[model samples]
Every structure is written in structure tokens, then in C-alpha cells.
Target: MGQRTFAEWLERDMINAYIMSPDSALSPLFLVERQKLESMLLGEQIKNIITCEEVDRKERHEKLEKWIRRLEMTGFEKVPLSYNGRIEATNLLQRYSHKYKFKEEHDCLLVCWSDRPLFSVSAWKFRR
Candidate 1:
């Protein structure tokens, strides 16, 4: 599949921090390796950066839902790596208003997607 991986596309966005949840635990050695990769992409060594976030399962769950809602607000319907812009999928990164948040500090806004349909973004689903 000659397509850009998420990390590849992410590099173009140049987001300040890419938040890896505490749930995705990695060994110290592996974590170091990942930090190295991140530093390479960022062009700086962000040493002493906090690796783990202190959040309860409940809060993590809540935050995840909130992000999904925002993503749905973006009006993108295709999956990120394969989205073609007419298939009725959802994307959340588009900012219609003049104001948007761009993090320069070690903070990132995290989002995830599943098998939701296009035209689902920027709208709601109601079921009984």
C-alpha cells in the first residue's frame, strides 16, 4: 500500500508533542529508543520530559470520548491514512474558526478513530 503512515503524515503537521498514553507502557530501553526517534523528528533533545501521565482510568476514558467528539466535529469521514474526501467520514483536525490551539510546550491533543463512516464527523449519531 503506497500510502503515508500516520507518523509520516504527523511529521508534516509538526505537532509539538505526540502524546502516548500511560496505557501503552514500554520498557525503559524501548522508551529511550522512542524518545530518540521523537527527538530526531523535533530536531531537539527534550530530556527530562515527563514520560508518564498521572490519570485514572475514569478520566482517561472521559478524555478519550471528548476527543472523539471533537474529531467528529471536523466533518471528515474517511479514515486518516486512506481518506479520499468524499466518502462520508470524519476528521477533527480541520479548524473552521479563526481560533485554534497550537501547542509549543510539551503538551499535545490526543485523538483516535475506529470504524466510523464518513459524514459522521461534525455530526451526531442517534440510535435506539
Candidate 2:
């Protein structure tokens, strides 16, 4: 009849049986949704809702800046530019070329890694 706390919902539904660990970080959207549900149970209006993707993007952006700063400070021969999305990679390659300059002849490389060991390192050269 009333909204439940996350703990209450978990206990009532016995959700712990399926989770790897309850201590794992929950997405911001989950926290917001939980708060909204709790508020609704207490007869309050829902104020806002946000997706987990937005939260993850913002966090990843912050991490990218930190990495860039660290790489710059350590005087790497080439700064590493990390991107989580295709759009971000495209925009950076277009607008920030001077900062992330690569040789026109060897401008792109792709590295793939997985948990298994029998993998080959693939490289690609892109013409600007």
C-alpha cells in the first residue's frame, strides 16, 4: 500500500539471490527512481527523472579529463585520448586535432583485448 525503501523492496522480493553483490554501486538513475518511489509512497509528487546513461557519460568525461591531465603532466611522447562513444571520438578528432595530433600516415590504431589470451593485436592506418 506504501512505497518501499530499496532495502525493503530487495528484502520483500528476495532479489539478493540473483545479485553478485549488494554492495556494488547502483546507477544514479536507480537511486533517483528509488527516491521517487519512496516519495510517491509518502504521497509526494515526482520532481525529476534522469537516465543512467547521462550519469555514466558525465562520470566518464570527468575521468577522461583526469587522464588527459595526468598524461600531459608525465610528458608522454604522445598524449592518450580516450573516448567512450563514437560521437565523442569524432568530435575530438575534428575539433581537437592540434591537441591530439597523430601522424597523417599512421593516424589510427585499434587495440582489442578480452579476458582470453589467444588474441591478435590489430592495427589500422587512416588517411586524413
Candidate 3:
């Protein structure tokens, strides 16, 4: 995705969003993991947005739908993510922070940071 598209996602909800703030109550290992992840994402933002690149203003949802349609054209069918797997993912996130959320919709697991969806995890299989 272009930097503009990526920035729109951040601008839409990430502003002032404290989705990954480290908590003193958490274990030191978890805190370190969170810091590392934050650093990686920040580095990406610096590379993509801070470098003064052209920004594509296309709607992100439209782009995502276009990709899904392309995948369908390639004979890939959306498969429901397993319930047990979703449960496991939920449990794991809950162990870290309740700020993260998972919503099951349209056979995909939507992972949200706070109220906005960060990304989705879905299974796909080729139709024989």
C-alpha cells in the first residue's frame, strides 16, 4: 500500500489512540515486546510518510475490496477462521491488554486496536 493510504488509516483513528501503551503492572517481557512493536511501526511511518513521498488519496476500504475481488477471481474462497483459533488469539491478547479486540464477521477475524480495526486475519483456500 502507498504511504498516503497507510497514513489515512493512521489519521482515521490512531491519533491519540493509546492502543499499546505499556503498563507497569505487566510483566517485563511483555513490556519489552510492546516497545519493540511500537518502534517497528514508528520506523515504518518514518520511512513511508516522513520521507516526503507522494500520497495516494484513494479510499483504503475500496482498495481492500479490490484485492479481495482479485483473490476471488483467482479461485480463492474465503474460509471461516476456526473458532478454537479465534479463542486462542483472544485469550492471548487478553493476557496482554484488553485494549485489543477481535470481532468475527464475514468469515474473517477483525483485529481491532481500541474501536478501529487494525487488520483482519482470514483463511482462504483454492477451490478445486
Candidate 4:
């Protein structure tokens, strides 16, 4: 991301997939923008994205096996984070920020658990 915009990166097919934390912010344009950046990709028009909100449920434990299978099939990435925002993400965030030259809240803004990928975060230490 040194000289590339988010949309430009997608346009050039530099990133195949990315891991995102639901705890971070997100927006619908994150995915929809892909179509805009890469006009060539729009021809196929296949839905390759899956959101956690679509699968979240209270009674899914009864179907644990199927749920696990579906989740595995979807290849969702698990990001660890704390509610207090005190988790140690130096190594993780630093690498991305340095590569992307992200500054201030924009770095934080790039990771979250929103619907459309405003940003991404991960919790590696523990879970709440």
C-alpha cells in the first residue's frame, strides 16, 4: 500500500483475500468497491463473501457439527481483540501500517468488525 489506494490494490489484484475482525468497523462499500476498482471482475458476478451476522444465532449449538462444517467451508478468519482496546497488537498492526503508511486514527479505522470491512482486527491473546 506504499503508493496504492485501497481501491487501487483491489484493482490490480494485489490482494487475493484478507482477514478481518468483526470487532472493527466496516461498510458495504468495502466489497462493492471491488467491482468498481476491477471492472473486469464484475463480469462473473459471483458472491464470494460471507458475513458473520448472516450466520450468528443462539440455537446453532444444537447443530454444532454442521455449524463447524459450514464455518470451515467458509474459511472465516478469527481475529482476537479485547473490549477495552488494550490488547497487544503492536507486531500485527505495525506491519500493516508500515506497509500502508497509515497514520493516526486511519490505522485504527482500517480494522474492525463492521459489515463491509472498514477495518480488520484480531484477538490472539485470549477471548472474552
Candidate 5:
């Protein structure tokens, strides 16, 4: 099978197998991770399966919150409560608060990490 076809099959198998024996196959941490991943996947699937714009908006917001929490817990400092918008992320850097900057450019939030930017967050993208 093609790579995309195999990936689809694998994702389906992961969900099906987890459903069939969640307790047996998944450790507590793995279960939590799986739940997060499943929530993200199911939200995307909902966007594809249903056409309601409201549902899509809610799902996207929920997903963004999930990601933000995940990032914070992984040591990405949370910006001050007074700050908002895309630049808020860069504003959270304690040491580089003055030099490092972020801007909304090219339809994306650009974070400039200078040579001396604070590197507080771990390299790992996800936590167990």
C-alpha cells in the first residue's frame, strides 16, 4: 500500500485497538497521551464529517487551548496576563524579554530567537 494509505490504516488500528483493550495496552501516561491525540484527531475528523461552522470554531478553540496548556506545562513561559496577541509568546521570555521579539508576518507568528535568547523549555515536544 502507499504511504498515505498505510498511515490511515495505522491510525485506524491505533484507535480500534485502544478501544478494544485500552486498559491492557496503554499505561497511565500512554492513556493520557492517547486521549489527547485522539481528541485532536477526532476534532479534525469532525471538521471533515460535519459542515457546521460553529462546531468547527469550537473545536479549533478547544484544540488551541489544549496546545497552549501543553506548551506551558512543558516550560514555555506564559506571557503576562496583561499581554495578548501573537507577540505575547515572545514577551514571556524572561531573559530575552527586551531583545527577542515576535511579529505577525507572512500569515504566521514569527518568533526571533537571538543568540542569547532564553532557552528555558526542554527540547522534547510532548510530555508523558
Candidate 6:
């Protein structure tokens, strides 16, 4: 659904929410890394498709705080991430390259490559 419509629903009193999004500030780095990884691990056709998708996402992406503001404006408050969830996420990442890591900030969990944030996961609940 469109963001406007989603916000309208939240304003009308939707309950718990979770969002997973690409971190726009670091998207350029992610796109480059993704392209390199794809080129190495996948075929040429898949790599080309991923490149196109990354270009489109890069054009459309917005900063993480923009979303926080949008949700907060609609009466949604940030929810603290769970310790178990964080532990699970960390364990999951260990199955891959060690360059991947997570950082918790502003009540959100960010997945990063080295030091650059690539994606964010956050939870929210309507303020009673």
C-alpha cells in the first residue's frame, strides 16, 4: 500500500507494527557491495537483474528518520527491540561473512557491512 494510506490506517488506531527497510544513507555502499557479491556468487543474468533493482531502490529510498517521523506523527511510538531477537539476529549473521554486524540505535537494529549501515529493523506500537 502507499505510505499515505498506511499512515491513515495508523492514525485511525492500528496496533503493533514492525518495519524492515534499507538504510538510505548507506544504500550506495550496499548497492556496490551487492553487485560485487552477486557477480562473484551468482550468474551474469542474476547480477544484471540485481543491478537494475538496486538502481531503482537507490532512486526511491529515503532516510531512516523520515519513516520514524511518519510513524510517530501517526501516534505510533518506538518499541524496544528484544534481547533474544538481537541474539538470534547476531547468530544468523555469523553463518555468513564476519564483515556483517548489527548496531542498536534509536530503538532500532541496524545491519551493517563493516561500519556502514545497510538495513534497519524497528518495531512500533500505537500509543494508548
Candidate 3, 44: how far from true, in Å? 4.5
**How many residue-pair clashes does candidate 2 contain?**
0
Candidate 4 lDDT tens digits, 98-118: 333222231222333223333
Model 1 C-alpha lDDT versus the unseen true structure: 0.37
Better of 2 and 4 by lDDT: 4
- Shift of residue 11 alpha carbon in model 2, Å: 17
Ranking by lDDT: 3, 6, 5, 4, 1, 2
What would you estimate as the lDDT of candidate 2?
0.36
Off by over 4 Å in 4: 1-46, 49-87, 99-128
- Model 2: per-residue Cα lDDT over 8-99, one tens digit each: 66443332222222222579898667645654543211111112355443322223335445545665434233434434644564563323
- Tens-place lDDT per residue, model 1, 25-113, is 56989887876676575432222122224542122222434656565577533233223432222222333222222221112222222
* Model 6 alpha-carbon drift over 4 Å, by segment: 1-60
When summed lDDT is taken over every stretch of 10 residues in candidate 1, the lowest stretch is 112-121
Q: lDDT of candidate 5?
A: 0.47
Error of 4 at 27 (Å): 30
> Stretches of candidate 2 above 4 Å error?
1-61, 79-128
- In model 4, how large is the Cα lDDT of residue 27? 72
lDDT at position 117, candidate 2: 20
Residue 112 of candidate 2: its Cα lDDT? 16
The backbone clash count of each candidate, in order, is 12, 0, 0, 17, 0, 0
Instruction: Give the residue spans of candidate 1 off by over 4 A.
Output: 1-16, 19-22, 44-110, 113-128
lDDT of 6 at 5: 62
Per-residue lDDT, model 2, residue 52, is 32
Candidate 5 vs. true structure, TM-score = 0.22
TM-score of model 1 relative to the true fold?
0.23
